[model samples]
Target: MSSLLDLHPMTRRSLLGGLAATGALVVLHPFAARAASNQAHLRLMETTDIHVNLMPYDYYADKPNDTLGLSRTASLIDGIRAEATNSMLIDNGDLLQGSPMGDYMAYKKGMKAGDLHPVMKAMNVLGYDCGTLGNHEFNYGLDFMFNTLAAAKHPIVCANLTKGQLASDPKNDELFFKPFVIIEKKIKDGAGHESPVKVGFIGFVPPQIMVWDAKNLEGKAQTRDIVEAARAWVPVMKEQGADIVIALSHSGIDAKGPSEKMENASLYLAGVEGIDAIFTGHQHLVFPGPKTWDGMQGVDAVKGTLMGKPAVMAGFWGSHMGLIDLLLEKDGKSWKIVDFTSEARPIYHRDEAKKIIADTKDKPEVVAAVQEEHEATLAYVRTPVGKTSAPLYSYFALVADDPSVQIVSNAQLWYIKDMLKETQYKDYPVLSAAAPFKAGGRGGADYYTDVPAGDIAIKNVSDLYLYPNTVQAVLITGAQVKNWLEMSAGMFNQIKPGSKDADLLNLDFPSYNYDVIDGVTYEIDLSEPAKYDKDGKEANPQANRIKNLSFNGKPIDPQQKFVVVTNNYRAGGGGKFPEIAGDKVIFVGPDTNRDVIVRYIISQGTINPSADGNWRFAALPGTTAVFQTGPKGRPFASKVIGAKIEDAGDGTEGFAKYRLIL
Candidate 1:
């Protein structure tokens, strides 16, 4: 084939003679040649961790959100696709469960065997070629996962998951889409010869599914590490005729390595021989786009040469799409990528003239559909569940035992008791626990889910419970339980107790989600440093801010055993909590904590959702109060005992102020 196309060293006269024979080619000259020179370029666009931003949907506002909709992304995708020589659209996962649409689509409306779930429905319309699964995919269990996947027109490829009863069965029919797929395309060579290129994509998720969603996976199947499975299969794909291999990882890129391979797998995965590029997500933080993974400063972990190979992890929740462009040199039997550029498709960009409109726009249909669902959800979410006799608050979460967290624990235990009726783990005494995922900083003063005398809408419930974390139970010793609280004490920045009011904590330490425990009583002595991490390493054992830990009105015994129930995020190593390790896990929940709360509310017919009031700070009597407030919450918060807004700023997020008045 080469012999037929090769041009031997020839005389100028011979070249002229050949060119004259093709008069049109001679006339076109460099104009035609320049276009050919740019032909091999392939622009790859990736959308990762788009947990239901189908329309310009916003769960917080409980309304038709116009800012964050995927429809806004459509215009960008269209413009990029129009300018590219060849391109492939891939979503990186967690498409099914974040907003009200997901909840409405899941347990409420319930998808039919062939019906497209709203997210899947919107994705199908967008025409995705490939995608992977974020851990959230299993939140609703396998049957529901498959039903949602079955609605997809694309391949749902992940190399690490086991389907049904077999780990290796081809018949497992695992995903709503294929686990990996290859796209064949043609590009013009330098001399106008048509060259065929095969771009292969392999998707992966963190293997911690065993801990994150154990109840859903325990009897159904298993999951393997992303790197190990990807390494084994990339070579197989090359053998099957792939030219360039890209990993669409639903994992994230992190600073601290080792344990969180899923978070920073790309760094090490870059060394994997057959891979050329990687697209990643799952941590919800964007990369190479104004973010840091731990101590590493300016690390474009999302865009880096991991082991000499290119990789990028897009930010989560449709915030950014990862883009990587590679130039390949045809090296006989294979194509070796010679140069590449990795970047995030930022939602907004300034033009050469320094103007900024939306760098993208919403897909009209996607916007319309998700908007319709968003409104319906709002109407449904607002209907009150019950009346609250008093306001619930989170200001004292980590510093003391919190009733806000206590409510979650009660709901989980309640849900577990009923779910266990027919399950094998029924005999165990279950205790539920949950940390606030969204307390204040992001949501402002109103962000704290304290409801005042009225019907509590589901939208309000979301603030009470953000994130769709399933109920997980870990079998822990009494000692480990105490250690968990010690780690939580990290939320407090130790100020020498009498040091004239040293700011001992990040006031913005999110209250609802970070609040510690409910089942036991303990005190955080303002004098100690946090025992654990910003990284999940061995926590300092001597660190002790918590004092007089007791359960059931007595000092707890370390030998006592109990199933510590919590969410998938915490159980799967989210906040570096102790005792929730994989070995100690007895059950991974398929039911979400929010769902449990909702169900518990329904069961009681009237929810007395009050804090157990198990813990409290000694007293802030001497310390001068300090906190800011937004226009919406300043008055109410200032009136509350020992609380006062000392300063304030308009919250860029819209309603609450970045208050600091103490």
Candidate 2:
């Protein structure tokens, strides 16, 4: 149990002299000597939030993309492993869903018990050491999740996910999988001597999965809070023969303080004792980057350190790979991490012109593994679904209630209107809430959904709805409905009464969070401050952004009860929307929103891609707000009669500028 410096003086000198004779101790450095004899370097590599991107191609666009895919990341992994003598590759989940490939497998093909899911098949070829599930993994239901997990060549671990419902076993008493895994690796010490190192790897998923995927998980599985699960498992991992513990957290580092339902809780997991290093994801953000996390205690964003422990969160969709290098020193029979570094490796880098250049090439071997499935997926998505009478696009979704969002809401209301028959909620007026899934933000200009006017395919359907979330209806009061719309109004900037030109859309607010209630007529006054903040907190408590709210050509009563059709993510508190969660949920349907859209399109024979003009911006005299959108939207500018759209000029970041008279 002696430290490297605590070695007997005579023994140390003899060791140094022998090495000096062999020209192995050129500088006779104190730490270098200890490093050669007593230390081992362990490199931990991670790929997270991959979301079923196996190839370097965008299935939605049916084109190649250098910025995404696990095949490109495989090249980075090969290069990283070559630099380090000892390393382990792990995936932080959300890999089974997100793209057309995921839908092709889950909905179209349907996975059987023995079938190899494309994601797992690709991971098996890449040689993943182990992985943990993310919230999206449960999007398809428990049977599908386990069936896909069974195809993995490597072990799968999740400490937080468990079995049963909240009322019966809220504690998450029974684990759904092995809590943690102890890996025994033979590594070279500073002096080239080999030793067995016991590395403990544990994993955790956000507890909110129970709510986010309630339709899939409710009675079948439950989840414990990430921090609580870490507290219980880290000690058990230490009690075993584990020398060092690494957490593969399928959670993000939210600077926001601890919450039982915090979607991103990697920061809290790192503070738990006995955990040495951590790999994080699910926020789809890169850590150790320029973004500063202000109030998080013990978090060094620049150094990628949390609670003084090394941590990394790779950006989602295989855009970046997270790496943690650990310097371990042996103390008698155990090993302790003495030093470490963390960083994220991007697949592509943007030049001065903002053109993305591939930083890593696709690995041929990995591509060869998933080639069959990739071709099959492309074929599956290419199958024609129906025809659109007009173009289905989302270029102006943020500024106006466009066709892209309306079609989704139309389908939801159509489905729910029929579903409510004979049910208790049948008496209430049914409304639908839908949001634009793609509006060219972090996803770039090409991210917008732009299906042609003629034929529509399954891939087009995936572009319309990015997630696999099921349809859900929540019974809420009219007052609660106003608060909900107020939350959606947070997507706009507060325009001054006489301002000449101000930014209209709050780019920081994701377009997906800007829900447009289809059945209600309302106006969002940009001159007033947002009633809710971007995080859905009541930032301006007295501010009222929603105005002229009415239903069925009459002023709606605040005490009136209404059923609003929406996705599971929103109803289960994904956006933190007020009065839209918990017991407020009246019905949870098994059909995904995507399926609903498909059914609606088929039922109508030929769909009309037109907005109903249910919502608009309230006029503010002498003020105008400038916004940015794709140039393609210019042609459809006159179609929006609610707002005065003027072509301003060229905008930054390759967007076309437009001035909207509020």
Candidate 3:
């Protein structure tokens, strides 16, 4: 490794000047001795939003995945450490809750005090310097979270998360964890002067945690604003003899202006004074990329900087490892960042033939650290719960109301009816709202859920429902339900009334927002413009895309109220639908949606998977639209009702093209 003390910029410049003045060569021994003491390189390694992917094995699929897992990332970390003179590893949160392995650990294995969580054990084996908690860490409640954190060898910091109702006031609310940690690292300057650099790390989570995990957090804990927390803590860290400060922000970058409740506030957090560099995640996106930070002000995408300060966000699920290399120069008694570079290393990539292949070889030590948990998780997810009469897949979920979504709706309704019995809301009619989570967009063609007709295992339920969202009931008027459906209908591109073979299925619309509301029959008109824009703004006031909305055999009364059972994300304004969020919630169930599905399957013994044909596209003569989906859906394309679908050819990103005859 090249030491900073090997060469001094000024000494080398003076020597050249002296040589230029005199023809004869002149060497200054004193200048040469002081040359190597003036410069040093500091590397900051980060892993963000891992979501408990400790091993390469996918518990949900009951198979191995090359694209995910910290074991694979460990090899990359080892290689980087070998190349760098000085480096420190820090995880940027969301480490505890996403995969079925995490679910298995929390629900099945159960983490007791002093017990090591598989993720913590693996991270300990890898020797993490410090870590911060992401919003998902609170998904299993505080007790489980604290028990898991107890096993972590490194310090866990979170400045924003606090206890009690005084969360907004940081002074009054006691911090749930250490606000920040000052890590002392040794480095040599250009003059070969050795000194300790106190790198302060302060962490922040999204304030929206108070809303998303309301049931688990209410009256117990709350989260403060990210920017506000950083602004307050950075100054404190500076006063505590910290040479440099790094903001380990669990929030993502979304907007230029910072709000108290904004989910993506990393841009604003970076602007905080005294913060030298930043680590960002929670959007599951890559920074320093043209597509994500395109045209954004105060950002240098090529150099990976936010507000001219070094920053990086590794892709989620252990797909990438973020690295920030800082060129430090001594400023009197402390060190300041003179220059820096940031990049993320991926674990897998696609070849010319489009075959996904692993790049980083897995570290056996990391794999061995959690081998027992890995085997148990595999066993837990593979256990069969029930049998299905027909295949359950989501390839045609967005194009039509398929059996996959119908099963979710049926399970929610069945669970909610019993829970709401003998209550005041029991007298009102019940409805169910569900959306396809795996329709193959950014996740690629193989991401679609395809469960063959046979024994349904716990892993299949995890595949069916990717998120760990709890069930919640929202009470809304019939008019609001129609508005909700209209927002969902925006998934289709508007086609001219008589235009031939127009494009359908808006590529920008997320499949998770295209909800299918059960217990109501509706038809979407492709001829009209969308009522609302993708941001939920009223784009066209007079547009009427939703037609023939009826409940049972009669037309729905706009004033009549109905209770819709859906996941907490939808009920908490995740999709930004019209008049469906904020104060409309009537009940919040304690069980997760996955658990509900599991219980429903166990109760039924054998599930009859079939769509009720409650929704269809309105007739548009002489007009058609082309769509794309997974090629696996071609066999069942003819069996789907409401629209004519024909195989076209191969589509972009390994998907199959399909022509929707409207």
Candidate 4:
């Protein structure tokens, strides 16, 4: 039902007389001059999951492009705002620490009072009204976040953050962002009088910040759950006499449990009353359109309302700006939206001559500021990181004791073994677990780091180790450790022994959480159903997807204790890996996982690494397979080099296929 309801004011009558009378004059009728005067249509704009892409601005590239900069988005914002009567721009978190700009600020550039963080600088030029906190904000700790946020002209709203034992306290909040803001504005009426509307906005972040950013916020502060916190605060928002309520969620949309499990947080939150519209991020996705997950009803394509309300999660980086237009019907003292449409505004559109021009005029000031930082960071992004003789690749991660994980584990164990020399668990066998982060998903082909044949530079290093996560080792029994792999095996759907083109895998599963234990050997039996416990417990250990679990040709003894090295998040149950939780954590290493890998590379001085028979795709004989995978993966056939891959041509950027190996 998308329609062209309104036309340019001048074009209303076709003004046939103008076309007939003024030959060249009517050719350049600006789109802005078309709308009515009482155009109080609120344009709710969003920048979701912008993981520090300041350049294009890609922190990964360390250069500037016309595509992603808030500068580019600013062009679209101007056009949309000019067409609307009123508007509000918001960022949905994960904004602070993903790119090299953030890395430069943290390690090289360093932050100080009044120092303009590039992303914040761009936001300042756009004049964003408010934003919510994404998990990445705490990566560098509270001081940097506090100082940078203080520099922004907008309000940062997050409700679940705790200050003291009570929900309200001076010490418990983010210390800068307000929990919510009630914005009031006037709209012109047909009588030439002003009418008032009150817009209530509140923000929430995923409660798991405690696990993911423990390096930043463990004993320093506490955060409550997103839903529980909203329940406690949204009522207060209503009591304040606010009209429309919106949630700026750093969390993603949710569907029913079982298949989705922890995935459907938004749907659960939507079930919460009074939440009029939800602007979601974190798991960056496009919603309410043609996209839908497997085996869900309304989700095959969500309607404008969930639990009777509008919700949207725009695509990530500066790719698109989510624009939701709601038509409100005035009812007595309150106004309820009668209908609505949500879409992302492209940064460019076809002009009269069919040339893709700026969606609107690019804002010169914002572009200049962002471009300046973009260039400075570009110079700093790709410098020499360290040398490695070993090659690190994820080709065999699912099957064997990999050298990449071995290097990381060795580094973690080496770093911690001495520090815990006096501890009782120091006598146990130590192993390290690490997952591949950048593997050609949304990052494109070059995203895969093959620092081949020579010195590894800083640019390639960023590709290999994207995040600045610290190392951590947890204590677990040999049995519990075995169960942990069973959970990871869930990443693969059950590929039948002789099935064709069935993905039997969940490629969308993030590799950061996909920990592979380099100290053990096991095989995934594509023929069997996976046994799993939803509550993070070993409720059903007999699930048979993983077979032949052993070490040195002997079954792993359940009573044997092992010191498992991993990133801090997994040691704290980030992926709900069975038997691994914060309480079982033994040693927290000083160096980050990225630092450990980098340091390991530097230590080796010339690391020769490869898949080297660590793991393999269980041999399938004479079967043709087909299943859907992602878009970026399409161009690189090595992603499915050994299989009969279909072009699919969808550019989904995920990997799932039915296969028959002769």
Task: Rate residue 365 of model 3 by lDDT.
Answer: 89
Worst 10 residues of 3 by lDDT: 1-10
Per-model TM-score versus the true fold = 0.66, 0.69, 0.69, 0.62
Residue 558 of candidate 1: its Cα lDDT? 84
Give the best candidate by lDDT.
Answer: 3
lDDT of 1 by residue, 126-244 (tens): 78888788787887787888888887777778887775443453334354345578877675545556677888999887776665567788777667666777767888888889999
lDDT, residue 545, candidate 3? 89
- Tens digit of per-residue lDDT, candidate 2, span 374-409: 998889668775789888888889888788888898
Query: In candidate 4, where is summed lDDT lowest over 10 consecutive residues?
Result: 1-10
Query: With candidate 4 superimposed using the best TM-score fit, by how many Å does residue 116's alpha carbon deviate from the native?
Result: 1.7
Model 1 bad stretches (over 4 Å) = 1-39, 63-67, 164-179, 188-194, 254-264, 289-303, 331-334, 348-359, 369-371, 384-405, 408-455, 462-516, 522-547, 556-606, 616-662
The 10 consecutive residues of candidate 1 with the worst lDDT sum are 1-10
C-alpha RMSD of each candidate structure in angstroms: 11.9, 10.6, 10.7, 11.9
Order the candidate numbers by lDDT, best to worst. 3, 2, 1, 4
Per-residue lDDT of model 4, residues 1-662, tens digit only: 01111111222212321232223223211211332333235568888866666445444433334445555556556555654555688888877776667776776777788888877888888888889888778878888887778788888888876643444532244533577888775654323345677788888777666655666776776676677666766777888877788888887655544222132366666666777888876654555444334445334234544555677776565656776666554567666665565655444433466443433234577767777666767776566545565555533333344444445556665666654555677678776677766544455544554444456654655556665455667888888877787776665666656565565445555555556666666666656555664335554456765566666678888888888888766876777777688789766543445555554555566655543343344566654344343333334334432233445344244443322342
